[model samples]
Target: MSTHDTRNTRGRGATHMENGSITQHENHTRMREMTQRNQDMERMKEEVIRHVQSRLNEVLERALTDSLQSLSTHTQTHTDKTESTNNRHKLEEGKVFIARCSLLDELFEISHIRTIYHMFIAALFLFIMSTLAVDYIDQGRLVLDFDLFYYAFGQLGTVVWAWTLMLSYTLLGPYHVLRVWGEQALRSRWRTCVCALTLCAAQTSMLGIFPVCVVLHYQLPPASRFIIILEQIRLVMKSYSFIRETVPAVLKNTTQKDKSQRYPSLSSYLYFLFCPTLIYREVYPRNPSIRWKYVGMNFLRILASLFYLYFILVRLCIPVFRNNSHQLFSSRSLILMLFHAAFPGMLILMLGFYAFLHCWLNAFAEMLRFADRMFYKDWWNSTSFANYYRTWNIVVHDWLYYYGYRDFLLLSGYKLRSMATLCVFAVSAFVHEYAFTMGFGFFYPVMFCTFAGIGVVFNFAMNDSRKSPVWNIIMWVCLFIGQGIHVCLYCLEWYAQIHCPRTGTSFWELVTPRSWTCNYQ
Candidate 1:
């Protein structure tokens, strides 16, 4: 029995040992599974970190390349701009150099031309002086008032005895000289003739109004109260003719057409016009006088003056006769009369009848044709002061340039030259003032003289006025205000005088007391 019990105990012990082995195997399998899961998680985390690092590297690389490209483009653009600026500067310098070379070339040419120019100018001056002397000798005193002559011509016989001699000289003379001296072809000669004739015809049309007025004045009834009104109407027509006929001719091509079959109608007209004026070699007359061009320009200005004078006379007479009441009684009436009746009426007279309104209507007809200088490739275009003076009154400016400035420069020093310029301007201003006074009275002339003196002073004081826009505006404003005040004072006096004529005031009191020679009855 003891052996059997011992065997059972051994069996139990074996079973317990097997159970312990089985439990140990199960615990070892669970630990192995947990370790496999932890290892898998760690491997996944490492892969994620590596992938994130690779993406970050790619992004950084792209950012670096983009930044570099932008910097490169900016640098190239800036460099290109800098190079362009430098090139522009070089080009400007080159232009300056070329201009200097051109100036030297012009100086050499002038030196050669001066000998002839001076002698011719001297002759012209002598001729003028002689003419003046002869007039003084005949009349016992020089007829200083040029307006009298202008008026006589404008109001007397402007048509038949039209002074279009200058147009004849300029258009005809140049080609004549060229033909005689240059031995130009027959075709070229004809072309020149056409140009000359056309120009002359056009100029005559513009300037011929004064002569027409003169003729009309004789034809029309005289010594009547309406005589002034008739003259004014004729003057308006004269202005219209000037603009229509003269401006176009002056602005159009003054050259005759070549033998080429182009422009048939124009060519035919030019040919017809030029044939009569040509002097076929009778030793072509040499007119060294620059006065011809001056005369043509003067024609334009003179016609304008006459037309304007006519306008003033018309204004003075129209309201009195038309309404049977003084138009200046009400401010509205005065403004309407000046704007509608006076200014616009004058404009219409100048434009409607004037042939050249086709082109020059936009231009300053009252001023000078100096604006042509911007397009004119000549000596006068190169200077500031010359340009200004020329712009003021082109015909007169030309006269001063040839007669006054050049002669003064030749005879005396710089001081005299300056003085001569001032003198010329002053003389011109005086003439203008005196002429204006005949129609509008004396205030304008005084103001004009004062401002002209200022202009002369300013020309010397400031050589470069491009940077002086502000100062220029200020100066102009001051001059305008001063002139305005002066004009206002005269207007007041005139207004007072007009009322006095109705109020029984003494005529001497209404007028300047200084000029009155009163003989008390």
Candidate 2:
């Protein structure tokens, strides 16, 4: 029984062992497959990393190349341009844009500005029609009387004579005296000073004393006297400019003159007297041809402006002033008169600026073939009183700056800019006041106060830095008010003279303003 049982147990154990061995083999095969799959995944990850890195490197290289190329192109362009500019400058080529025509000339080439010219013509026609209608309505018929103008401008021959006298002094005397002084000054410096002083005294007599005599002794009418006196002032200013400009050169070249140097030619002197410029250059750029058509047009503009002024005075000034003359004088009355005069005053200002500075100066310049025609800048567009003062009359400004201010600086050893400026202001104011006094035959200080007090205040207050349009409007308002004051006061005095004739020509009576005491009512 024991032998059978043992044999069965041994057989079962051997079968069980065989089954366990099969299970172990299957487990080993599955583990080996999983390890193989993990190794393959690792190899794929390495390949992906290498490929992405290579692509990034290519992008960086391309971006750097493009950036370099752009930088190179820009650098090369700038360098080429700079080199060309340098070469041109170094060569000092011909015709380097020395002179161009005025900015106004360019604008005139445009249609809009030309249209403005037509507008002016239209305005002139309107003025004519208005004057005719007004006169026809007022007097029940149109007389077309020009007698007032004729009477105002009566005796212009004395003006011509006074002008001739002033011109003779300027043309003939100054140069010779300068030459003699220059020759003598070569030996001694004090001699130069003495001779200069002596010349100054002689010039004062010729320019100042003689013209005053002509004005007083001849008893010139207001308009005729204005012509002479203004001419006198012009001559004095021009002569001073000439002497200041030329005397230094003469003195400097004295030794050079002894040793084959040249003196200023007579032709140059004559040209300087006639030329529009106050700062004289011996040889100025000239036009190729005289534009006679332009000259004729300018002259026509002058005549039109004169008629325009006449119409304004007759229609606006006479009506306003004549009606008001009978009113009792008071601050209220004067203020009302000023307000009424504003339009006519503005018209007069415009006519004065356009006629004298633009038309008259341009005509003379064209006829003389003077190339530099920058008589006035855009003064109407000025934003400040200082700017207006500077651009209002460039000719006069140049003279005063070169002669009065600059010369004063020199005489004062070049230290006082403010003092020099003040001196220039004083001279200008004095001359203006003198002209007014002589013309109106009264010593009213309106112009003097306006010029010295208000002008100075505005010059400092509304200075060059004021660039706003508001400031420009303010400047214009000030100009209108100032012009209004001038027209009202001067016209009052004019009527006052006719209404209140003085019994005696004593100093007090002649010098005092008749407008203050007149009872036209």
Candidate 3:
């Protein structure tokens, strides 16, 4: 019995030992699986961290680049504002003035702008050589005769007399009348009205009736006519400027104490006449000294530009138009002529811009020490017609903006915005058409249609939101086509006028374009 009991105890102990070994093995496997999972979780966390860090670096880099560009642009703009402020802050002993800015002091710091000037100079040289080459090939040798220019500008005596008369009236009559009546404290509405009427009548006679009479009666050539008409507009604009500025102040200070204060000094008025500005001020910012070399260079460029225009017109226009008045008018021929004229048209456009905006204005500005040189902006790089027109001729634009468009807006109490825009376009078109008609001695509605009609269409179509390069290309293409059409059509009309002389002295016959009936005749 003792031996059987002992065996049972041994069996139970073996079973318990087996159970213990199995439990040990299960715990070790569980530990191994948990260790592997922990390692995988750590690896995933490390990868996520790396990815986030890289993204952060990229965003920071882009932000830094953008910040730098903005800073540079702002700095440049600030520099411009600073120079402009410097220009108008002259404290003459007794003279008061408005604060303003100049463009030259800001733009010249950029090296690329100088490069652009050099490029234009190079282009001038190229233009000269190109003209010489064509002349040499056609005429067996170069025959440089500037007789066309000489003849067109031959009778300057008449223009000088007209200018002298206009200048004397502007310098003497209006300035004195404004001061005399303004100082009297008359408070007479009828007197003011009479003075205003007199001034208006005088201005009209000088700018309107007198010029039309001279052009029609004397029958001046195109170039000489341009001188008289442009001067007429210039004088009118200057006179209006003087009145616009001084009259307000005079009326504002209607009190007895303010009456004794002087109108703008005579020297200021004279300076305003010669200065390259259409806006009038009591005192203008002046340079300390004149740069004679700069003046001479601009004048030289003006002469070169004249020759350039001569070359372009002679070589590119005369040959094509000399025989066009005799040819049959067809869509195909018209299209061909337009395409051919495009080259010279562009040249003419560029030359005119350079000659007037840069050379002529800058020369006068330099001589007058007119430091506010914001005459034009960078218009060539414009992507929209709206921007282009604003930048093209800032002086004229300012006049129109301040006097015409703004006044109309004010008069209408800011309503009729579209109508105001249309009015601006109409006035501009009228002036342009008038100038062209008087200069060329014909009424070819080509200038009017392109400006008032097509120009308005484009102004609305290619608006300011179009900032892409594609839009810029389209704008340039349209300019090229428009200019080509203008040149081709004008050349055709000019030739027809010469070839088809008027048989009857009727007003309609004189005003009518000869090109239309010349082909049919």
Candidate 4:
């Protein structure tokens, strides 16, 4: 009985031990699974944190780059605007005086250029000989008659009187007004307006209306009319420059009541009136001494150029155009005439530039011991019409740029540069047309169209970006064609006006171009 009980107890004890081992193994496996699940969750949490950090970094970098780019662009725009404003201010201040010689004067110092000038003199002699020969052949005798010159410059007294009166007014009127206004203790806005109106009215009546009235009332010839009109324009410009340059100083001094401030002297004003430059200044660059010989030589050259122009007109222009009114108009004939006139027109243009801008201005400069002789630049080398206009007639161009274009920009608050450019072109065109109308006694708008229409188109189209030599050639070709058209059309109109009688005594009839309907009987 004891053996059986012992065996049963041992079996039960063994089974209990095996059950305890299985429970221990199951607990170890469960603990290992739980540890692995915790490690996996920690790895996923770390990966998500890294991904979020990377996205935030990308967003910050993009925002920073955009903000920097925006700042840079704004800075550049502000810098450009400031530079533009400064340039405009400098222009308004007045041209800086530099001691320099005229372009042609420097060129004439070269042996080769002097030879070319000698060639012109030789050509003038040849022209004289040809004229003598023609006179001998036609009238069976040699006779020198400058009937054209005499007729062209007929009204000398009227021109002198008008010019004297204009000069007197320009010298005294602006100076007196500025002096009186500047002496005032306090100038009100209404007072300033009154002064301005008074100046404007006086200028309009004396300088503006007087010259035109003289020309029309006396029936001035072409050359006389040109003299009066050109002088009128010059005096007007001079007066305006004087006022423009001094008024600011006057206002400033008067406002501050500066005892040290002094008005421009009478002697300086007198000198300015006679100076070659249109710009007025209290002082000008002067030469150490005047060379009367140089002045004489320049005057002689100007006389020679005048004779050269006369010969060109008689030999090349008159023969072709004098009888043109008798012929019926045709497109082919017009084309041929235009082509034929191109060379002569170009010659005249060069002659005019050389004579007035170079010879005459230089002569006056030498006489006055004026040092600055940069009357013109190398316009012939210009590749664009814009450059050409800037280089050619630098005197007038400076006036126009400072007064017209820059002032317009200031008035517009720098918002419309393109519009300012358009306004400048319009004003220039109007002035040119007015001068031509007054000079020629006709209302031809050819110059106006050329300046406002084709000139504007070319200015934009043939911009400074064009650097190719082909563009230069194209510019020259356009100039040739334009000059040809100007010559041909003006000549035709002049002759047609003579040949064609007016059907009515009306303003329209007078203003209308007679070349449109003149058919010779």
Q: Provide the clashing-pair count of each candidate structure.
A: 20, 0, 2, 0
What is candidate 4's lDDT per residue for 121-207, written digit by digit as tens? 798899899999998999988887888899889989989988999999998998888787776624567767777788899999999
lDDT of every predicted structure (CA atoms): 0.42, 0.80, 0.80, 0.86
lDDT of 2 by residue, 59-146 (tens): 9999988986787687988867776676545433211112445546655756678899789779878878887797889888866787
Please identify which of the two predictions, 1 or 4, would achieve the higher lDDT against the true structure: 4
Q: Ranking by lDDT, best first?
A: 4, 2, 3, 1
Error of 4 at 316 (Å): 0.7
What's the TM for model 2?
0.77
- The residue ranges of model 1 lying beyond 4 angstroms of the native Cα positions read 1-387, 390-395, 413-415, 441-444, 462-466, 475-479, 482-521
Q: Is candidate 1 or candidate 3 better by lDDT?
A: 3
Q: State candidate 1's TM-score.
A: 0.30
- For residues 87-145, what per-residue lDDT tens digits would candidate 3 score against the true structure? 33421012233324334434554467778777867876776787778779988787667
Residue 479 lDDT (model 2): 85
1 or 2: which has the higher lDDT? 2
What's the residue-level lDDT of 384 in candidate 1?
Answer: 40
* Candidate 1 residue-wise lDDT, 44-158, digit = tens: 8876786799799999999998986787687988867776676445432310101111122233344456575456446445545654686789788764345433443343333
Worst 10 residues of 3 by lDDT: 90-99
